[model samples]
Target: MTDLAGHEGAWREFRAALASPRMHHAWMLTGLKGLGKGQFARAAAAELVAEPGIPQPPAEAHPDILIPEHPPENKDEAKKREDGGEYRRKRAIPIEEIRTLIQRLHTRPTLGSRRAVIIDPADDLERNAANALLKALEEPPAGTYFLLVTHRPGRLLPTIRSRCRVLRFNPLDHAAMERILRESAPQAEAAARAAAIAAAEGSPGAALDFVDQDLGRLHQVMLRLIAEGDEHFALRGELAEEIGTRPDRERQQAAVDLARAVVAAELGRGDARRNQAVIQVHGDLVRLSGQLPTYNFDPALVVMEIGALLASLAMPREAA
Candidate 1:
């Protein structure tokens, strides 16, 4: 079971609501991505579908619950057909999927007093699919509960948002982030863990993703590049080339993210001269990252360009 970590307050509130006489039929778990919103919804649903006085069943064992999310595009149709016509996951949860859930909910519960449905990210629902869900929320079947997880609740229909109870989740604090890092990356050295946590900026999910990376070393390199100004083009170019050559997208993205964090830290240190340069570099990195897939830009050239910009910022006026 994934620990809720910094979400104790939200959990306590939910438990209290469950114990109340007038329990809500639907709830929207609103939080930034990677804050464990999906895990909380699944755990809560398990308890909801369990028989009274019985321990909550595991997610897989709970027959009266359904957790649906957008599937990968590469889902195997033959495998799905072989599995007795089970719904093949798709890139988006279409109206067809919601209709299927609606049809299932209309029937009596198979395992317990209630049926529970959890949508890990309701934001992925298309217009028609969202409307289909709205009907269910408007007139929910008896003994049915809906848990909708959304990073951006504002994008949901106003009527849907109005009908559901909203549970807000905040980002984790430093202590909570450190604890999560220790649990998730026990094999990581202390310095690596600390660097990841600092780079995470109070997000455990971010910290966990960075645990295996040598962010501590990378951070120092970034600082050294900035400190060296534009004097050593060779060193800066070499560092950028290394960053650009990583094969895995996630690793490369994480490295870029950590580089931004280092700049943010530099900005925080009250250095006025480099503020404009830092901001420009950060903006350029973000723009380049967004366009990398669509434009097929070479990552090595991208990094090198960023390095040149940084170096030029430190050039003396006479040299300029």
Candidate 2:
């Protein structure tokens, strides 16, 4: 909940900005996923709603501390009813939503000394939506701030990015991750957490995916297959049944994704000294993912063809 950047300078800068009562109208947090972008955004917002050493705001979704909620007009806004679409759905934060948020910001704070809004992954804003938000940022209301968090700042409108103060968030050290893993997920082995760090590519939330039993099995199997060829065709039928029978569209896509990652890793065994192999397998991976909804490419066939192609790169003909 506290500023975890641990850099006294960044904290001082923010606190000084707060003292001046002129926090950046829009702050862009640029970083990789799971590096606590959302958590940091909430922390920044809470500075307005919930100060350090004080109790946290009753709920992060409180109206004064606005984080965009997706309600499709069928649900009550005050009660925060679910609109059937998950909160993470990729719909633009409508102009209407922004206008309502502005109305809330102008009202006297319900609890905290200040008011804040956070738009996670601000890069998701549609072109028109981004421009609309930019207009507001151009003339942000006094005593209110917007924390725009994202993994890809380059994807945001250049004009939008220019309007904000950019803060780059980096990953926590191994020790920090170990501490978090111990408290939050003791069931995970220390080594598992460490290995997950590698897979996360420096994202903490990403490593949490290892908690899934299915993904754990896949991660291990995937790594093994990458280092050593899985000559047995046993996994193909297993993969097919697992993928073909996924109950939801999301799970089905995840299965194709799992296969793609497995084969892609194998293809990248070296410094891509075998890049042709990597390219060929990457194309198959894309095809496999693309066809998950449209066609029924036998998963076994896909895996075998991928395996065979990678295997060929190691054959005697390529030795010359």
Which candidate wins on lDDT?
A: 1
Candidate 1 lDDT tens digits, 1-320: 44478888888888898888888999999976668888889888876777866666678567688776565335576467567776444546878778888899878988678888898789778789999999999999998999999976876999999999999889888788878778888888888888887877666776777766555665666666766775747767666655656435555566666666666665544355556666777777666544443354566665676566555545553442
TM-score of 1: 0.72
Considering every candidate listed, which one attains the maximal TM-score?
1
Q: What lDDT does the true structure give each of the candidates?
A: 0.74, 0.61
Number of colliding residue pairs in each model: 0, 0
lDDT at position 245, candidate 2: 44
User: Candidate 1 at 258: error in angstroms?
Assistant: 4.3
lDDT score, residue 29, model 2?
A: 82
Q: Which stretches of candidate 2 lie over 4 Å from their true place?
A: 1-13, 20-22, 49-56, 59-63, 72-92, 105-113, 224-244, 247-320
Across residues 12-128, which tens digit of lDDT does each residue of candidate 2 receive? 666677677456677888876667877767766766566556566444756567876443433354234354433333234556666666667667766656678788768656576
